[model samples]
Target: MEKKIKPCIDNEQILKQRFLALRDTLDLLSGKWRFCILLNLHYHQKLRFKDFFEVSEGISPKVLTSELATLEAHQLIQKKVEYTPTKDITYYVLTTHAQEIWTVLNTLIEFGLSNRQEVIRSFHSDKN
Candidate 1:
């Protein structure tokens, strides 16, 4: 038998909680370098520390280290040590979960492109 689907609604408390959580998550992922780091890994498969620094120019070593640690902690990316010996370094690659996030971020990019001026104005206004 086919089951009937009920439309679900969120009450005020749940809505507020969810909104706050979303804001927090976005804040973490939308830092100056986090989004670019994620996109680079997603598109390029993997990158070394210098590769990341080169691709997303102007990111300091300190910021890159912090962002990479945060992304790894969030389970959005993975670090693999390759050729262990001497220089034996690691590369960053996106986890499956990060791919899912990339899809949503692409949608947001499209939306932002369509509203670039409005977004700029809003951002500038918020600073005052």
Candidate 2:
């Protein structure tokens, strides 16, 4: 007789943990500046490090670097080096995954703008 395969309970627990981790990552990237970065990238094709610094006004260099690194690590964006005779320069471009994320971000932006007054009032009321 052939041996029967049992469903792994531990695998389900691991999958749940993975889901929570993914959710936490999304929440972390949903911050103000991070969202701005994504929106800017969606409109712009690719940007050099300096261009990003210039376009994303008021963002500290350290924070921008950190956010870019996080996005790169998540495979949402790609870093490429453009070779030159003098020096190699790196630039950031959105990946396919990043484009998909832009769709979700757009929907979120539309919803937020539509409900801004309500959200603001709720925040103030909750502070009491």
Shift in Å, residue 104, candidate 2: 0.7
Global lDDT scores for all candidate models:
0.87, 0.83
The TM-scores, one per candidate, come to 0.75, 0.69
lDDT of 2 by residue, 1-128 (tens): 99976656558788788889889877768766877877777888888888877788888888889999888888888999999999998888889887878777889888888799788989999998
Q: What is the lDDT of residue 82 in candidate 1?
A: 84
lDDT per residue for candidate 1 within 42-64, as digits (tens), equals: 77899998998778989999999
Cα error, candidate 1, residue 3 (Å): 40
Error of 2 at 26 (Å): 2.9
TM-score of 2: 0.69
Model 1, poorest ten-residue lDDT window? 4-13
Candidate 2's displacement at residue 44, Å, is 0.8
Candidate 1 residue 57 C-alpha distance from true site, Å: 1.0
Candidate 2 colliding pairs: none
Query: Could you tell me which 10 consecutive residues in candidate 2 have the lowest summed lDDT?
Result: 4-13
Which predicted model would earn the best lDDT?
1
Poorly placed runs, candidate 2 (over 4 Å): 1-22, 117-128
